[model samples]
Target: MKNIRNFCIIAHIDHGKSTLADRLLDYTGSVTEREKQNQLLDSMDLERERGITIKSHAIQMDYIYKGEEYVLNLIDTPGHVDFSYEVSRSIAACEGALLIVDAAQSIQAQTISNLYLALENDLEIIPVLNKVDLPSANPEEVTDDIVELLGCNPEDVIHASGKTGFGVDKILEAVIERIPAPKGDPDGPLQALIFDSVYNTFRGIETYFRVFNGEIKKGQKIKFVATDKEYFADEVGTLKLTQVAKKSVKTGDVGYLITGIKTAKEVKVGDTITDFERPTTNIVEGFEDVKPMVFAGIYPVDTEDYEELRNSMEKLQLNDASLVFFPESSAALGFGFRCGFLGMLHMEIIQERLEREFDMTVITTVPNVSYNAYTNKNPDTPFIVNNPSDLPDPSTVNRVEEPYIKATIITKADFVGNVMSLCIEKRGMILNQTYLTPERVELTFDMPLAEIVFDFYDRLKTVSKGYASFDYHPIGMKTSKLVRLDILLNAQTVDALSALIHADNAQNIGKKMCEKLKELIPRQQFDIPIQAAIGAKIISRETIKALRKDVTAKCYGGDISRKRKLLEKQKKGKKRMRQVGNVEIPQQAFMAVLKLND
Candidate 1:
């Protein structure tokens, strides 16, 4: 326990976290020369191609410091706001965090947010300046910013370049000298915190946990406190480059345990693991349940594969515990699940993962934030509406309250006006603004979560020229004038395309949806009228002109009268086809609604 140093690396996106992790792995001699690669901890191919860490990867390292062998458990976390839950889990399992700030970017929104998380958990913070090798890097200015933000002395701020491994040795020395070892009693009953878990087709479910008390041994019967299920510990091991099996993992150590529990529901992340025979009196706590901000429906491309889709989702949930979903059905898109995601990026990643990992082709409906719907009859109790179709009838709905978030944006001072206007256009209310420096500003706004669900981030990046960093958290729900905007193909309603929109912007958005759908949906034999409506009132409509057939081609030199007859006959056939034709909506149409501003 005295030799163990457990810590995690946290930062904003593209702040050299994984690069630094690779350097740390190399310095600690954790990996061989053959395994050296960029983003060595980011195992997902999607993560590699996109240059983002979606998962928190934990690995054990052995280092010799002061002629003594020290064990270091390092967890590299994702920098995106969408994966903050991953950072939180990593924080809970560790005693300290390496707060890495980019020399050029300084401290962005997510960097501050993640730092607050570590502070809340009372973890020791080590501020490290990365990217010192870049020509654009301003080590002195960033070091000053870190001093003001963290209030640490100038000398305490380590100057390091993850690119060239400069000051890499100093960072290791700081980890051992500053970050304290894990605290626990090895003699007490087993009390472990299940920080994360993963599914394996061959070995069942593998739970990665930190032992807070006693020890977990192979063949020991373990109990999951929250689920109240017991299973024999089939395998116990430390998480190395590969899982290295051990006879036992004692207190203040991080390791993986395989219980051979195939059921996903039984093995819950953040649950407590205890010895079944001598269970701990107090269950380990403090892990927060995931709060899903965006709700969308995921339906299989083929309706018969609904069960297979469900299985794929379960497997995904094992790795990403933040994903919340329940069975739901829609009139437009048969049976599916209504999933809750952290943000647009998380939702997109999950959809891509399902297709790539499980070979499950799925259709995602329009994404929206959850709303509280109050009715005239049941005014006291509010109905949580996740889908527009789930909203009660307009006449019965007394009022609707939509979720709001406190968004914090840090950008260059020159782009202040642009950021302000963008937020205001989305019905955002200004909270406050602070000047961190003469050229940098931090603006906070109270904005609707639904407003930023679409293209707000992209627009922010564009308006700020990629210098702005944004982060947000829910600030409770507020009553708003909202209405259910529905889309109709011909006279039939498409529930999957429907969305709950603010009454003020409903007409404009509806109009845009109609026009966008017109371009995406292919022109069929008959004209398809794409209509956007609020109840009986059709706010917007666009027509996809029918594909005209040259019925009079056979008459090379036809008379005017014969041509007129052929035209009239074709018109009649088109009218009949329009009445019975089924519109084949392409998958891209559903996603088009997300990028309306583009």
Candidate 2:
């Protein structure tokens, strides 16, 4: 086991973690020159388009160190806080973490948060300062910051520019040295962790697991400790490391296996897979259970494609375990699913993936957190609401509290004042401040998770000119003066996109949201009066003028098919819209309103 090193690359979003993974795959000769792929770890189209690691990817590479063959099992973790749960699941499959911090940017809030998660898991961390080739590189200072922030020896840091391949060998050497090899009774029962899975049209479902003890080979029967479902391992394979296909996987390896599991319900991420014959009494734990904090409803643009949407969601669930969905029935829209996610970004990523990969359009509801409404009829019963329509009566909600996050923003010294002012404006409470470098400072704050889930990051980036970096983790619920702002279209609630905002800024925020919605939703067949109000008082209003004409005059017989096709396309376009009694709203309207300034 000492010859095998399991590790994950951890970093904040856009800090070059995926790029480093690509370079490592190249240096290890995992990708042949003939079959080179750019950003090989980002297999999903959405991931490549967003330039973010939405799903964690695992790859195995054989590296020769000091004339000895060592297998380096690499896992790429999501850097965004929205998928922190996915990051945790990925971290569970590894024995150590390669802390990748950008040399030019220094330590970020996410860097610190991920470092703490690694420490909490008791995983060895090999610090790597990446992007050293940049002119603004400050490896030495960042190393010192790492030492100060984590109180760990700076000796573990390996200065290397993943782009230039500098110190790549040294980083590899440090992985074997700093990260301890897998230690378990290989001869005993086979216990593995199901960190992730994927479904193939031909092969059915393939689950990725890291064996904690014992050897699992092809044709061996295994049982999931949690589900008690048994299946034979038809094939054992490792990640191609540079491609999306499966290679040869073995013991003490981080890879996947085909067990002929059909539906995604049989095997779930974070479940325990074990040898059925061995029957170990003690099972290895995977990761903390990830709960979806934000909830929303998703409906197809065309109600006829609802089944296809469900099938797509099931396929997506094979790779993404954090996204959750349940059947929902709405009067305005037909049968749909109420989906839950980590945050707003997670919600958007899922919605976009469904549209792009499955070739289907969907109308998504506004994201809302679960709240416990106090009432005499059901005082003890906790009610979960996704759409504003599901919200209990305001009088029944004795006191409303929403989840908050302990946020930290790191930026250049020059923008500190402006950033602080913005934070305060969002009702953020300053927690602590420290110098990451002479020119950079890390400011910690206690802000509502809802605040950062919106345009806070974009605003931060805009204010700092894309120089500011931020990360946050849920800090539990906190009481706030919050109210539900119902978005009405012609005096009727557009149940698809209602927002709960703080009473103090509800007017201003609602105005901004309605304005963005007006811009996002194109002119409809009828003029739509978009209005935002709290209870009986109106705050903001915008009108989407009626569409004059969306079709052109043509021959009745010759152009019938073409004109009918165009009308059909227009009708299909309307199917993608959400009809709120008398008004029609597009899917992007909800997303654009949530991220108004972005």
Candidate 3:
């Protein structure tokens, strides 16, 4: 156990954490030249194409240092803010973290956020400056910044380049010398922390865990502390890039357990696993259930694919315990699921995975943040509403509270003014601003999460010329003047198109939505009226004119009375059609309205 090191790599997106992981694998001889691949830990195709880590992966490596064999457990974590929960879980499984920062880009928003998470976990942090191979790299200045921010010794910061394999040996030596080995009792009762899990079609639930006490072996009966369900360990193994069956996994070691439980509901992340017969009285602490922050409705393009979508979501939930969903029905969208996510990116990844992995076409409604609505009569009993359509009558509601987030943005100093302007437009309150370096600045703001969800990041990027990086965490709910904005297509309310907006910006947003809808909705046999309304009052309106037809074209020599009669008949027919016909809105129209930020 003294020679064992359990640690993870933490960094902002595109900081080369995966690249560093690949180089470490090579240095440890975990993968041979023939099998080496870029971003090996990112097994999902989407992850490689997008150049980001969407999931956390763990692997065991055997390294030799000074003629002594050492066991190293490397857990590679996602860098995106949307997967912060995953990062926390990964941090919980390790005793230390490698805080990697790009030498050329310096510190980023996620870099600071991830550093705080590592500190909160009480893990030893090794500051490593990466990308020194770039021509613009400035390792010295970056090391100084790290030392100032983290208050670490100047000599402690390691300068390395993951792309060029420079300082790889030094990093390994630091991991062996600085990071502490896992401490536990081998003779104690079996106690393991389940950090992650995945569903296998042939083997059922495969759970990844770190053994904190005692040992686990094949055929041993173990129970999940949270579920209180017991199952015989059908297989026990360690991951070596791939799973390799083992005789036993002892204390201070990380591995996977295959219990023949056929359903995903039986396995839960952050749950403790212990011996069934000799169970420990104390369960592992800090095992909180994942709570989703954003909600959206996802429906299959074809109604018949509903069952398949449900099954796919179930399978997806097996790996992603953070995802929450239940059955939902929309008159316009048919049967679907009301799904909750940690953030917008999390929602996009799930939607993409459902289509890519499950081969199902789906339509997702506009994303929304959960709100608290208090009734005038029952002010003490506020109801949580996930969908705008679920909001109570405006006259009966006393107040509304919307979710807000503490956003941290880091960018070039020249772009600070632009960033501030963008934040103010999104109703953000400046909390603090500090110059990290002469050329870089960090700004903190308290902004409504709903405002940031709609094209805020894109606008920030445009204003900063792609130099700004952002990360945010939910602070709490704040009382606000908010209202439910409804879209009326031909005077009929479309439930899926309804949104919750601040009252001050309601008029402008409604107008933009109406204009976008007019451009998206095609002309029909009758004129279709697009309207945006708040409560009983219509605030904005646009009309898509009906396709015109020459009713008197055949009356070349006919009398003016004949032409007038034909035109009158045509007008009456158009009026009747407008009264009886329903406007069919395209799916793109909904997406356009949701993306209307300009």
Report lDDT (CA) for all predictions.
0.94, 0.79, 0.91
Q: Candidate 2 on 311-346: residue-level lDDT in tens?
A: 899999888888888898776678899998887778
Rank ordering of all candidates by lDDT, starting from the highest:
1, 3, 2
Give candidate 1 misplaced runs (Cα > 4 Å): 554-561
Provide the RMSD of all predictions against the true structure, rounded to 1 decimal.
Answer: 1.2, 7.3, 1.5
TM-score of 1: 0.98
- Could you tell which candidate, 2 or 3, scores higher by TM-score? 3
Give candidate 2's whole-model lDDT: 0.79
Each candidate's clash count:
0, 1, 0
Cα shift from native, residue 543, model 2 (Å) = 5.5
Highest lDDT: which candidate?
1
Model 3 steric clash pairs = none
TM-score of each: 0.98, 0.88, 0.97
Which parts of model 2 are misplaced by more than 4 Å? 150-155, 242-251, 376-382, 510-529, 537-581
Give the per-residue lDDT digits (tens) of candidate 1, residues 1-89.
Answer: 89999999999999999999999999999999998999999999999999999999999999999999999999999999999999999
- Model 3 spans > 4 angstroms off: none
